[model samples]
Target: MKTRSKIEEEYWEALERLKSGTTKSVDTKSTRFKFTKDAVGREAGRGKGYVRYERYPLLCEAIADAEEARKKNGPATPTANAKLEQQKALKQKAIGDYNQLKQEYDLLMTEYLNVVRRNFELETGLAETKDVKIIRIPNVR
Candidate 1:
């Protein structure tokens, strides 16, 4: 049986080789094991034909850890930058749309208030004054 540390080390080496394009896709646990075995060579308890099904979970964990590390430490590729720019543009468009809607709301609200005040004056038999301010008190239920 191989030690955990040894297995992890081999996994990392294989991952690095894959990243560097020295190896192809390690898309499956079996392929990952094969890559690790090929890089670190076969051990006594884990011979060439060994299925190593018990180590599948550990290999998956290693792959996840490696992916996270790559995201944190790897260079900002053009694809990543393009995605960021796309998100920024979407956010800016949303902000602009919100501002436009807010302006339209304000305009509509002013027109509605004007109409309500005119109707109030007509109903109350009050003179049409330009400076009359309406104080709306909320009814607490």
Candidate 2:
């Protein structure tokens, strides 16, 4: 029933001992968790050391605990929730833009048909140019 903090503190202490070369040879993880012989920093040995699961069991456990908590608490942090909200807003805006474009297209198509019908009626002598009616919409933009 140890808390996450307790497990983490012990892990760090053990890691420090291993890195300092003070940990006993009998310890099962002494070799596995030993600090890499390759030096760090620019041109010291090779590349920067990265954390590996086998060498950092406690860290992995802490990460696993966080993931489990996230499952129960919805998202892990406010930043993640904020990102989700941002995605939702973007999707809504796209849908709104699409709907607006669709309405404009419908309006333009209707206007074109009205003009064509009016012109046909006048040319066929079915009605005078003044007698034919074409729709007028104001302030489209």
Candidate 3:
């Protein structure tokens, strides 16, 4: 097994402790000091939020990594997964429709060739009405 670095270990630990609770905190700040607030705010619009970069820098680094992973992977909600599934289904349907059209086009091409061959035979006087084999235009199955 690969060993976890101090920052990575702290990140995992924090993630375990926070779970879904980490989203409740905002990252706002004043120019001088550092603090944080609940997502809704008891401090109203003045959300005193910003951790000192020097203090618990490893944990901060870990949190940054977590946030970066979330940004890279995007939303993991049921709605997002459903959208992916829906897109796959649409692509499959489009491919099926294309294959169906290709088969139909091939059948029509075959009928056209049969008609052209009959016309050619008649024009060359190789086949008269009595000698001609009646080839009906085929219906698509």
Candidate 3 TM-score over all chains jointly: 0.35
Q: Which ten residues in a row have the lowest lDDT in candidate 1?
A: 37-46
Q: Sort every candidate by TM-score, greatest first.
A: 1, 3, 2
RMSD of each candidate? 13.7, 17.7, 17.2
Root-mean-square deviation of candidate 1: 13.7
- Which is the better candidate, 1 or 2, if ranked by lDDT? 1
Encode model 2's per-residue lDDT on 27-103: one tens digit a residue: 42322321332111111212334334665565545545644553574533458889899899999999999999999
Name the lDDT value of residue 10 in candidate 1: 61
TM-score of 1: 0.35
Candidate 3: stretches off by over 4 Å: 1-78, 126-141
Clashing pairs in 1: none
Q: Which of 1 and 2 is the better model by TM-score?
A: 1
- Worst window of 10 by summed lDDT in candidate 3: 33-42
Tell how far residue 59 is off in model 2, in angstroms.
Answer: 37
Candidate 1 Cα outliers beyond 4 Å, as residue runs: 1-78, 126-141
TM-score on alpha carbons, each prediction: 0.35, 0.34, 0.35
Candidate 1 residue 130 C-alpha distance from true site, Å: 24
